[model samples]
Target: MEELLQQLAGKLGIATRFSDGGLVRKDYEVDDAVVRYIAERLGYKAGNRGEVEKSLADFEKRRWQQTLENIYVVEQGKLQFDAVVPAEQAQSFFALQIENKDTGIRSEVAFEVHPTDETYTIGKTIYVKLLVAITNELPVGYYNLTFTVADKTYKSTLAVAPCRCYENPALADGKIWGYALQLYSLRSERNWGVGDFTDLGNFIRMCARCGADIIGLNPLNVLVHSFPENASPYSSISRLFLNPIYIDVEAVPEFKPEDLSEIADKIAELRQSELIDYAEVYPLKISVLEKLYGRFMADRGSDRRNEFRAFVEAQGDDLHKLALFQTLYDIKSTYIWGGWTAWEDEFQNPNSPAVRKFAEEYADRIRFFKYLQFEADRQFKQASAVVAECGLKVGLYRDLAVGVGKDSAELWSDNDLFIRDVGAGAPPDAFFPAGQKWCLGAFNPYVLKERCYEPFIKILRANMNAAGALRIDHVMGLMRLYIIPDNGDAGTYVMYNFKDMLNIVAIESCRNKCQIVGESIGNVPEGFLETLAEKNIYALSVLWAERKDAGWGDFNAPGEYPEKAFMSVGTHDMAPLRMWWFGYDIELMHSLGLMDEAAKNDTYHKREIDRWKLLSALDANGCWPEDNLRKDNYIYGQGYPEGIEEAVHRFAAKTASKVFLAQLEDILHVEKMQNLPGTDKEHPNWRRKLPVTLEKLEGDIAYIRNIQAIRRER
Candidate 1:
């Protein structure tokens, strides 16, 4: 029974063990209950030994009977694939035809199958290596493959991609620096409470004036519009679409600022608050948008109307599906209550009769939702255009979140691709001892491969079209994911076809002329960083994580940093530089009951030492401010001297890295983190607004001086 379970697990792509960053391997013994639960979810009867044996035999038979995979993706320099053929048919001639996806050009080759020495008894099959070496045959693009054997014809997709991702040409001149900020955190006098597309355009122009080439942003994926208070850009409803809330309502052609007289007082109140009140902001914007949408709908023969129609047609089914999902969600929340999970079984499937009926009845509402996306897309592009106009090199760097929420619209639209009832998360480590479950859906590796990665490709193309570069959050998921089943405790890792995934990324990167950066921060697997470097994917290097020795106080000098990396002082998940230097996070964690007294005391002691060591490292790297004191004379409670934050940013800028980034919070000397990882509503995560508005920031001496120093150092 145990042997049968092992065979089944192997076929399902579940890892029996995994090694940590330290190269210490730990094996997960086959647990009967966990195995049975996961198997049942995957549509297998694993209740008893006899059923398990049948499942294993069936899986093996299906795999052995297959002649070739549905899709074959290979790198440019290496082009080869294996074919499973009957021993008697091994000597037969096979005809191969390849047609380019973009161009209608076609090529053909004829060859005999050269079988390997080994043979499988399941179907009396032999492995044959079919090396495709044609004179100028395949380039870095997708192709339609046709293979013929005797009278039978088989079809599959062939993707020949570059081995490495696209490299920005600006890097050859010199290193470039940028500022990373949450878009909603930006404050402008003209905005309706929260930051909008107009603010983004203005901010981009301001950064360019300081000679910064890049502007990194938090994920702008669509979230639950009905419950706007449930805000966290990372936990989005649909990654393939843009968030409509970021649209600049007043900037719309049909919008009139004088029309907002009824809600003028509400907008002013929201802008005055220290934090963004999303609940109020969402409704206020919608009320004004509905008025503008009405005006737009009335303009029958206008060019803008035709443009919207053309956009709808170009977006096709993906836009329609998202609009439908949002419309359904709105009705469900109003009457049925809860998310899509609470809907009737007939309405669960997008193609079901009930859903079709609902979509038809509410077609106008769905069209309204689509209009929201249209405006959002239009504004986002306008903001992105500001990058080039301002002479920035690598402009508008966007972020792609790791996964979607469990009850996300993505799951509702296509349930088969997601492994329902399972979650993707981190294993127990130094910080999270009990382990963490993010409550996000894990992708079914089998389904993704079977679908020829169409879903994944669509997501890449969507985000890549709007930015000069894209940062994939938790890029390690391309290799393996720590999956925890709903019924199990800490679960095991599930491996993926990482090589094929990276090849696809390369194809998309080159096609869009966008560079790629992988966030490889915590609990990294062995050789992962090296693999990222080889593939031309920049690995993330946090300032705090770049230590030279065992002691936390010993930091790496600027020269020690890797050239192929995205260097930053901190991320949205960690404390800002000012907070880290002051040990404010330690105090906050202790007050939140996340750390005990002993742990708090020990962490504070180390933090004090780290403060001094950081200054010493900066001084060694020629980044320390002349007026700052680095010795013991600098007291903890007395606060850091002027230009301390700028010096920290300058330290990162002086690194050997090609791309250096400073958080906007750090540049403005904000002490709070944009988010605390574990806590959701307990801590005000993703709600804090920038203390300084864009109008003031444009002329603020400290802001200009801080950004200029980074530009100079780079």
Candidate 2:
């Protein structure tokens, strides 16, 4: 079993990799069931010893010829492969499909490989090198490489990227101050049940005045509109587009505030809510937006219409496909349905005649969908401009989710680029013992290259536009992803060409003049940080995770944090700073039944010790918040400690890290966390609203003090 497993692992490149931290190999279950699962995932199976031997033999015969990922440098290219056929029959002609992404000039450049008179033996394959010079200029973007040899076409991809990321001007000092927030959770006097770009604009202006360089946000990508209850910012419906729910209806050009006398009633009703009622907000906003779209269209003046036209044209087939998908989806499902999968077969294919007929018949409806995106873009761009005018450096920090839901516009539009049968997930990291299935179908590396990463580039450009910095959630996904088969309980790791991916990220970052920050946490692969550093991307540093000793791990010195990191006290998935300080997370987890009896007790014991170390660090900086109780008094049995919130703020602020980001929850000391991972309906995920209104937040004394503390640390 061991010998067979090793043989399979070597052939499939499915060996164990990465850790929850910088060290420790990730745990993988390789039982008979798991072995079979891996075999099935890799397109092989062994029923008995005799069959296993035959399968092993077959795998060895074709292992070299099967190219999972074909990688090459920009312009200068190399093609290496193992061929089972006669070397003389390998007459290779490389056809490079280059798209000048910036200018939109696409042309095919073909050339022959050098020294084609090469035959291959059974044991070894031949290598071919090519200087792929183009007659036309090509942008630093992904391209398609097609190689034809012996009457067969070998499909591959060409990824073009610069050496490093954008030269960040904000790196003058080692420290920067920022505030992290979930945009939808924000409450404002003007918002309609949820925070809009208008609220974000105001927040940006206020944060700038309070000496903040950036304002981090949850993923602003589009979530399920028809299925509002499935509102998770991290698990989005589409990562390529902005959410229309966040659009400020009042900001539209056709919006007539005076004429909205009747609609004003619903707006006020939504604003009065504590938790975001997505159901109410969806209908109310969509109805209003449809009215706005009608009004805007009635005025046949093509100036705004021309802008919309340019946007559609610039967006290419994607915008049209998304608009059509939404139109078709609305026609099929409504109110509570989760996805667009149940639609007609003709509608399923974006290019089908049924789709064309539906699109033309419901042209106005489709335009309304396009108009919604346009308004979102306009308001978001305006808010970003406000960030700059208000003098914030990395003004509106954006988040890019790791992947999208299986039934998403992204997958629907670009079905060829993803592995549809399986979902992407993480192996058992230190946190999730059973591992985590994100329920997202990520891009297939081979197909991603085959398609020249067209969908990927669009997703990146859309996110980078109108933002100062982009935070790539689960950035480790670029290096490798655990792909779970539909038939398997255990998943196998599939490596990505991160060298090319990083290069592409660098190119996009530089093009947008935005800094790239990667959210890499829990069982990181060895040298992943170095890869990010090579691309000049920043890392995420959570206060609770950073420890002193490698043994049990205590808090380390603030000055010892990563030079290029966004230092923060808490993450959305974890307990807030106040909860950590009081050891309430343990109690909360206990109540939630997240841990076993032994695990719970052990966690509580370790947290108590870590709490003391945290307090001592706060005391050393003279930032301890207790009115009378100090660290010494607490360690030596004080009566009680209070006001530790202020101490926690200052603790993160004093870090010599590149950035100190204080979440609005921690700044205002909101007791409840934004999310609790591994639990869905048990907790109110992505629906919590801010305790204070945006208007009140600007003038809040405590909030002001917290921001000032962070700035002082910077």
Candidate 3:
């Protein structure tokens, strides 16, 4: 029991003090001594003791609960707390509160649309009016009135009606407005082996030519290091900043000089390649950037400096702190996770005068990081503007990850709002028996509400600022999160509150006029889809995950799909259709040596079932030869067993989803997936380069026509 308590305390980063009677204090108090002790234990420098004590005193005053239940136990030389909320208390705690007149003045205004006074008709259009009644005088201020539908925003004219009510105009159905593309892969000319902004521009042009209204890409979120080999945009260091790696250094106005001939030549060499090689491209780009920075510094102008300073100022203090953290990170190298809790005694106590003085001294270094972010934003916006010039309706749709990294800037800056001792992850399912531990720290539910949901609002505003649409990865997390306590196994975790979460999502989606696509996959609660639909959030339909059971029907069939959903054949996680069909990539298994006896048997059984299904489908379609000799030939063919391509197209085109996305890999006949989940080393994830360069892809007439045909059929 003592050992278990010690392990739990270590994992939670809290010190446990034991008394002679076997009673223990977890030291939930935050103070200089505690902070310094933790920092020293975590291997960070300590600054001053006096400041730490003051900060800790203030922190302890804040209302905090270390346990869900008011109960404690002691055994041997250790103590345990019942942190789990009891059923009786849970019911009362999680119950919804009803609005009352005494508590707050409230009124409900309904907007109704009526074509011919017959509202029940499906084809009839309706106009609605809003009515508001006030019992007391409201604050005088400018209030923005906006309306959103299916992620599209529009403003309604406000008029002082006869009875504080006004009727607005009605909108027609089936109007051909511009549709935004919500999923896109970036393309680059000099992307080590992957696509970049240059490729994105070219792809946007192609999309424009094909009558695509918008092109959405994965998150371009900033990372802590240039070489961590992280491909997920959702797992970023700072949500407010941009990834400098995506910056087009050549596009800078100062780079057009003739003396930069060598840099231009390097871009040319990279453009000729079909794949992106990040290892090679990152170093070369950084070296050229250093040279450019040197040149700019040597001939620095007052105007440029002022502009940079203004950019730094606009980011505000939180961003400055993040920048300072980054600089400290770079200097210490190994202290990537050394946040305030792990810093030296003086620094650990945020209220310390010494820490404040240190921040003042390193202010310039922090400003430099902010300047870098400002430049990145300026360049990316310019790139998007170019795409808009090409007549694309929605230029960029950004992705938002389900959660933040445990040691990210957001967690450090807002530690009180985040529960570091509990991590978010998926529960066990058919796909992964052991479940998944994402190593992400989620926001504390109680704290988030007490703070008026400020954290969520900030994230939403930041992400929507430069995006046409937003895809919430694992969108179900917004409703309920599976939380595993520190040092606890997956089975011991409990579900957190989700009612308030739904309201927050609705408010944000309504506020941001940007369309929302919920990646609603796996273990979703009953009626969750219905609720999302009610909130006007679109559903995502992945072709590979669709089923043809009687209840679910054939998702590939247009009539069977949901009208408000988006359809795609495969995502970055799955193997390309061709590879899944061929089963040629066994190197991943051999390299990782993860294929033990049990795994080998599981793989064999899974593959055999898939093979049988494929053969059955072909036979049912009448594509198989009737004659024994011809049947054998068809089965032994080098390419696909015939009719598979047509089936795939038919499956996608027939979906009832309003929008369909075709992967460039499938169009170009690429055989491997961009990423393989689960194994870090075994999976050659996020490293595969496109088979053809952006230039060559632009010229692929057959590939272009094939996609055009599919779109036309749809």
Best by TM-score: 1
Candidate 2 deviant stretches above 4 angstroms = 1-71, 74-160, 172-174, 334-338, 344-346, 596-602, 625-627, 631-643
Q: Alpha-carbon error at 173 in model 1, in Å?
A: 3.7
For model 3, residues 1-714, the per-residue Cα lDDT tens digits are 244333333333343431111112121222333334333222232345443344343332221221121111111111111122212222222111112222343333233211122111112322221111222322211122233323333332111111110110110121011222212234444443345555566666767776665565777777665454655566786776777767666665445456357666666666555444556666676576656555555666757767766877777776776776666555545653544456666554344686578668876566556756776777777667765588655456677888877767777666777765667776555455566788787766546655655567677767876565677888877766655555554422223334445545544544454667789766566687887776566778776556575223333344666766667777777666666665544435544674565765566555545545545543453433444223333333344644454445545655567556666666666677676667665565665665655566657764565455466455
Local accuracy of candidate 1 as per-residue lDDT tens digits, 1-714: 377777777777775555444324443454566667677666666788899888887776666577777888888766666666667777676788888889989888543355677556664445443433433446799888887777778888888889899988987567888888799999988888888889999999988887888988999999999999889998888888998889988888889869877878888899889999999999888888888889999999999999999999998888898899999888888888768888989888999999999999999889889899889989989998898789899998889998999878888898989887788888766677657898888778778888888889988988887688899999999988888888766776777789988999999999998989999765787788889889999878888888876435478888888888888988898998788877899999888888899999999888777777887887777777556764575535456767877778778888999899888788887889889878877789999898999989968777888877886787
- TM-scores for candidates 1 onward, in order: 0.96, 0.85, 0.69
Ranked candidates, highest lDDT first: 1, 2, 3
Q: Which candidate is the best by lDDT?
A: 1
lDDT tens readout by residue for model 2, 1-714: 467755765565454433434245544445555455555545566555665677777765554345323544452232232223344443443344544434556666644344433333445555332233444444566555555454566655555666678756876444578888899998988888899999888888888777788888888888767777778987776777789999887788888877468878887888887778898888888888888898888888769988988888886777788888788777778542546666657777888888888889999998898889888988888888997688887777889999998888888877767765678887775577777788898677766765555567778888888778899988988877777776665776766767667777876887788899998875577688887887789888888877756536767677777878888888898887666656566777778888777887788777667767877777776777455445556542232355566667777887777788888888777778788887887878888888899999878877877766665556
lDDT of all the models against the reference? 0.83, 0.73, 0.53
Candidate 1: RMSD to truth: 2.1
Q: What global local distance difference test value does model 3 have?
A: 0.53
User: How does model 2 fare in lDDT?
Assistant: 0.73
